[model samples]
Target: MPASAPAQPIKLVIWDLDDTFWRGTLSEGSVEALAENLQLVRDTAARGLVHTIVSKNDFAPAEARLRELGIWELFVFARISWQPKGPIIKELLSQMQLRAANALFLDDNPANRAEAQFYNPELRVADPTELPQLVPLLRASGQPDPTLARLAQYKLLERQQQARTQYDDNLAFLRDAQVQVEFREGPAAVLPDLGRLEELINRSNQLNFTKRRVTLPELEASLRDPTRRWGTVRVHDRFGDYGLVGIYCLNEAENRLEQLVFSCRILHLGIEQFTYAHLGFPVLAVQGDVATELNQTEKPDWITVQAASAATETPAVVATPTGQQLRVLLKGGCDLGQLTPFLQAFDLDVAEEFNFNNEHQIPVHLEHTLLLRATREWPAAEQQRLAAALPFLGREAFDTRLWEPGYDVLVYSPLMDYTQPLYCERATGRRVPFGAYQDITAEPPAALAARYAQRRFQGMSEGFLQRFAREFEHEGPISPAEFQQNLQWLRAQVPAHVPIFLLSGAEIDVPGSGETGARQRHELMNQALAEFVASAENCFLLDVRAFVQTPADVTNNLRHYHRRHYRALAQQLAQAIGAWQGQGLGHSPWADLKARAVGLLPAKLRGLLGR
Candidate 1:
């Protein structure tokens, strides 16, 4: 406040993951995948912008992930605990002993970015993926100190230390420390202050997820629409405080609920999408009455006017691990050929699809499949639906369970639920692979190793597989309209119980310049990717090089590297789907393996872990 006080030198750049820099939650992948933007960070810091990470995860996992990815050194300070990132960010400035004027805060969350701007209008907000061009924007006027360059080597050490601590009981550690999120329905006016909302958006990952970001005024106007129903989800409990973490928007027409989606933050609270679903059901009931009154005609074919029966049963609800479910029913993709071998490796039985004996009253379940039949070509709408899903397109959607109509599986899930996926495969636009692992389950590692040897003996006659592979190229960034349409199709399938998953990958050719890869427009691809993933619950966008892709079938990849990792993915997918309680469920072995792995850690760490 004093004119005489020399302004504190702008010394730091705070980073928020999720929608800020890259798209999707980084925690959803392996360390290899999480560090997709490492080069960008290193170069930025070298230009004198001090880097830091501010997130809402427990300190241990966040720290471990950073270290595993070998990017820890780029951050001068990291506040990765369960505290609301806004306050932690303020504290970070203090701890680093810097002033708001001297530090530029960055994050991918609209709320976090908005809140940072609200609290400190001067703070520089950014998406980590935009750093290449951003640095020039920051230093367009002059030269910068290069001391940060030396910090890169230290990053490797951080990763080494993280690798050392990873297995020390992650589950016990998580269970012992739980983040209980509570929610409530309220008028739009109840939204949190700008700063608080920003904190929630940026730091509140894992639940209340959404990709559609509207400015506060835009949010209010949308809510005020006569034909639109809006609901707000407030989050609070234990870890600092994340206020107003979720929002759902739906348009009601003749008797149908359309355009339903909510923030991904409060997904677990069941307050956002559930509220939207509840709202849509009433409109549907009203429509039925209108039809009866207008026609006075005998009730049409399909079971109609079972108003009370409908209220008691929500047949379809889609969700991803992020917690948000759709108000519309979506058909899950089916790939029959991929499902059998994938499931076999895990030693689980899968039905081709699900059948609801509404008369007998069987709860909706995504029955697994045992075999593949005649190939049915998938509808263009469905194919387009998933391509829009991006990184979150898991094995459930990408593997055999996903049908291409006559060319694919024939089974159908009641509500398209894609919380987790086994693996997402994309043909690289580029040249050769270093090595690809083959999946081997149902046998000890040694026995599997023998199988590999036998396969190798046979393969030697053919050739090495990785030798023919190469890095992937740019298919160009996916569009938001593509995703919006995908959401609408998902709603049309059944009762709105399905959740959608999205994935995106970025390629950095010449790191900085903000233009890289094929299209060369830096932020466009990442931003579009973020928006797409955010539109769904627990959506994921994997960096092509960031996370290692785990193949569903051993033969899918020549190396046969399945068991050490394949089972873990199955559990993650199952848990994401399991959030809904009635679906998910590939098999228990994957879950059991995951539990066992966590059990192997120290009790303290295990106490803090969860699927």
Candidate 2:
């Protein structure tokens, strides 16, 4: 059947920039990344796909910046506003005279995509990162695809796939949206991803698929599983190149196609039905001895969210939230994501610091909980430095004035002074061991404090702290052998159940010298790390000496900001929290951490409740 084009002829292919183009925190990023993004948009338009923008941004200032870049005219229409995007997108579609199916909607945020899908189930949804591959499907080239039939279900095509009108999923949404399977098998090789599968998977998910994502290990592991046969297909039709576009994973015992997915970008090219008789799989269900069953898609595990309404709990007799003065410092750093979500979780007012002294202690609406991050991990400098002042005498394109560094400071000692602090290392995704305190014999608090005093004299001073800090740079006062001895001692002391992470980061002065010493330094850094941890009795030591020794990738000096790989570390923290919950760390262990933190701390503190 010939396709029906929109009345407007789609002279422009408009897109939402934030979550659509790439997964990014709307609050911050570098000018360079933003420039590359705009260039990508223009390039897409240049490739015969006219592009436009209908995003939610501050109008005058947003357009002014785009104009400065000389690509403002690329977008024929922009619904820039603070209102909900559903109406905005609908308005654009109506103004452009386009039907839902003909109109392709791209957004990074799942809520926005769902809203558009709810309004018009037939429209195609995608992540902006998938744009380069998806343009073909909308163009005059690609063939008809049935994977799209499932998308209609995701947006309410049928009872099996539609969201309940009232909304009853968080975990289900994640599992369904995030369970990605690729068919990478070659053609004539008897695997699913022969020719057309890769295209379907590329555009399968809009919310979770990161750009340039690769799960090489998982793909390789499937080969060792005799029960499963996995394959990927690379295809290119007469029109253009279709990079590795399909994958297939099947379970021989179950006689089930464990995984069969393709990129949606190349759909409608008549390659959709390769899964049918062409691939030797039936599309319909089996009834007799399961021999006639169709291939089954992979099922994903979903997270379970325990329900608890704040309104149902009895009101505590504590004082209500009150305006109180507090000191805040806006230390420079890279914020891969905004700090607002965390702050809002605690329900507090925040503002930038104007001065560092008591004068800066502006009044904040004090809540029952208030925790300030005095020292977050970040780079030592801002991300964007003036290109001209790069003082490097060596041959280089430009100099970076700022770098994000690792800040290994801990949150205010968690209610207990542990002999060996339980730190979660960003590297290795495991616990590590550090320090010299070797015993926790159920001793009284007084006895523990006394024991701590003796160690404090040796561990807390300038000599010890300096030496500890220098361990990363390989100038620790403790010798290599002594460090190993300490590690053995620590290993003997720690509890087997705990994951101990002992970390010693480094900082190197990258002088005018070239990048020649990096390898040797890497080896030294690795050795120092191995010795540091190997010496500990029961702790895992991460030789982040080399890792943190270099300045941060972000501009912030604090490691918590997007500097020192903040998001990656945050994920580790999240996992640790998940692990902690799994280990039964709280009353509800699974109760919402943010909610419980705000509600339980006051009771746990006995008398220090704040309002």
Candidate 3:
């Protein structure tokens, strides 16, 4: 028994001109082409097949006829000449870097088809009438075809190529194109587009990291699996939008890159670098053929890794109808409390400390309650000390109801000094002057004068190092490692999208004396605060000291802002909101262009250009 013909993958299909491509010949007969055949070429190409013409006629008139039919550009690598069909098809295939076995040749004349097959035996020869039936059979592989979309992508790519000649450097051409890339992950990903992903994976010869193929059903199963994380990317620029051009999958637990594939149309853009950087993952160094080639090229310096911190000092944001409503959780120093009204004036939702007096100071009982909840384990003596101080402390734990989650911004300036047992005047019931607190006795504070004597020591005044070690079961002062863990815990309590605005404490003054020690301590605190902000993601430093370098007319206090500075604070808040709004979907280049163009047109013309 003879073996059946092998099922081959068709990369390119060349059409004959005289009688196969259309109803008539170009030179003698009318230049009429069948609209159905033209659509068939477009539809077939859209399925990821490259279509071109192999005509035996004068090049110009034949090209002009195809142009008149509005389908000239659809044909890539067209060869219109009097040369023998076999040699022409062979050259075109060689230039495209495709194999003869992966190509199909269609002609009306049996001699032309026989000659083509004789030269390249693996090439499949078919009658023009057979294409309508043959094309469907060829697409049995079920691979995703992006050829339809490639038409637009290639057009943009051609324009980019042409623009490259105008610039001396490639970076200049890319920058001039004004490309914007947006990455999406989690529930927003297009994992349901399984066929597209499968095609993307198989069609990719150079950049397919894993080179593994999964069917549509298997892909759908992966999307449903909670253990796997997936993401898709969309690219847009001045010329056009390349919708959903890239897809990636990662192991949720291991954070390992499973598959990475992008359309070759965007290879020049250095998308791989941007993708890895934005996702905060290093390149996997997978050993695919294309990956090997990519590794040899010079590393791209033009692509910027997405900023880890959410805050942009001056973002180019467009204005929106409604302003951003942030839930500003004031959890820091008294300065943040004073800034509440100013924040509210800018239409922000302010949630100040709960169960506090007008001064924004936590009473001793409330402090004890907070410490009790925050305390994991403490020495018996330390626990007793807290118990003894309880009667003198206020009853309310800063209202628990006020500690709601999902706050848009957290104003965190935790009172490091106030937490010390000896320095806590609110618990001891004596208002020792602010600068005198460092002088507390060997024992906890009993009177204001004892605080002054305690200041005689050269080290930290409250012996906080010893007390904190015993209470928290830790070995030292708040180390950076501890601060980082605390920050992570705080992040876990809120939504991932919430940004923390850390409020740094104000510079300390001795009131009556210019004590260098007090300035040193304050400077140390500021330095530590800056480092803390740098270590954490989505946390921005809002230096309260920046707004209070000089006292305002309404108040001489250094810790909090005066009413006179509210306008300046409001302006800063407005700019932050505006910057966020500007990054929204409304900021698309197309939208901006339309708005500008419509603005220049007259009312009558605008009516004609109505939405």
Candidate 4:
């Protein structure tokens, strides 16, 4: 039986790797790569269609085979484990931030396709034998993406999702992400992206608040109309750039939004809410149930306006550079590493000093305020002895770039103080920051060592774990009063002229997350942070609670958030930095374009280019 035509154009192609993508099963023997299938993926991907995998094979070998076939990186959110096809496909779509209707699953097994359709009633599924009939339609699905920019954006989202899992706290992840948005208006700007505007207006459903559809000619005319205010939204974060992901048109005469639409790619980043707020919450008569609800009062502070829109009350002044980039030192968890790319988009020289696995294979976090004080006040002998004795604190544990004088500004997150527990040394009464919540000393050495071994951490043997338990006592998280005092000390330590931009913690409860009373803890700490920032000179707070409010806003815990939030956080950081400097940071359009273009290159070529 022939598969019926889908109601929506296919944006994603889910493959069954065993007999569908290749000739045979990898678990049994070597499988032959299908040339036609390979060509179809390459061609459709270039046309902005995404591809993924759903296979009942070991992830490692299957991924290795795909890489060998030179198409591994082309797919996002690949589910290769031995899981039920139906549930996995449903979850995969949710993770990819895509809808079932916009995805097509191709499998060799009739049972597998039926299971997928059963799980997702709107999902379109077909047998692998239908490729000959569906090839042209698949190739013709998406618009031309010469740079494979859409594929690259999905890859960026893939990297972000991978990173989000590492964090236990969703708000913490978002605060470190550093998301930014640029709104471009006028015919000179919005007209060039006419095709994207048309697609977003007509095809977008979930985020298409107004449900307004317009043809190319109609859109072109609307852009030129004096009665309408039109704009395009471009976003970039620590992950990568999402170029022109949204469009908005307001009927100025009636103070209503005529057309408000965005690609599902930018979902959960609060782009739509931010855009509505940016437009002063114009009267938008929503046609149907939309993914986001627009409110008149709340404006998402996480998202910063990079380019001034016509609606901006006070336009930022783009700074004239002095032939040199402002040196910025970003210090936080390794998760903040996402902010580097987005921060570099501005006229700033970014330097990252994040947590890393030391030579002992123990992950060392150096961003703690207690550790910062130790770096300055602790005797050299004490520092060296602790660094050598403790696997958690390697030789470089006490070392930091904070003392360096070259950097002009400091972008810091004091989340370690909010999350990490303090361990006091028995001999010298010196306090050290390590781990979070759980008392590692209480756990059996065998169990602790086994956990460490699973993580491939060396030097954390049973004997060493026993010794660590004996020598150090867990002191719990830092007290708010002590936290404030430390902040004062840090302010005194840094040069007064250099402004310190601090990121505050989110205070939302994540129900299933085992961290009981974490929200209350964050609330207490947030208050302490706010008090410090209010009184302290040259200190500003980037409060994440402004946007990361609901449980749905986070992932596993209160600290980690969806990828889009990171882009919004980056923009807020840039805007705050600009305010401190009395001018907006110089944006590199070519740098952003180059970043997107780099994704379009072939995987081999991208690796060769060292991207």
Q: Can you write out model 4's per-residue Cα lDDT over 1-611, one digit (the tens) per residue? A: 26555667889999999889999989999999999999999888866799999999999999999999999978888998988999999988887888898898999999998899899988888888988888878887875553466777788888778887888987677666676788877654555345457667877888899998886447767777989999988777788766667889999999999988988777777788888998999999999988888788887677767744422212222343568888889998766665666677788898989999899787888998999999999999999998888888899988898987878888888988988888888887988888776778889999989999999988889999798878888889988868877888898898877778788788888889887778888878876676566445566676666568789888887777654566567767777676556557788877655545654677587567644
Model 2 over residues 433-505: C-alpha lDDT tens digits? 2222232222343554455456432223333333333332211123333333333333333333233333322
Q: What local lDDT does model 3 show for residue 558?
A: 39
Q: List residue ranges in candidate 4 displaced over 4 A.
A: 308-611
**TM-score of each predicted structure versus truth:** 0.25, 0.24, 0.41, 0.50
Q: In candidate 2, how many Å is residue 463 off?
A: 7.6
| Candidates sorted on lDDT, descending | 4, 3, 1, 2
Worst ten in a row by lDDT for model 4: 309-318
Pick by lDDT: 2 or 3, better one: 3
lDDT (Cα, tens digit) per residue for candidate 3, span 250-361:
8767777777778666676778767765655634657557632443334455543232122122122222246546566766444444455445545556676532332223
- Which prediction has the highest TM-score against the true structure? 4
- Model 3 TM-score is 0.41
Q: Write the per-residue lDDT of candidate 1 for residues 297-325, one digit (tens) a residue.
A: 23212111222112222123322345333
What number of clashing residue pairs does each candidate have, in the order they appear? Answer: 115, 81, 10, 20
Segments in model 3 whose C-alpha atoms lie over 4 Å from true places: 1-6, 29-36, 42-50, 67-77, 81-102, 108-123, 127-150, 154-182, 189-206, 213-230, 235-240, 250-255, 267-270, 273-298, 302-320, 323-611
Q: Which numbered prediction scores highest in lDDT against the true structure?
A: 4
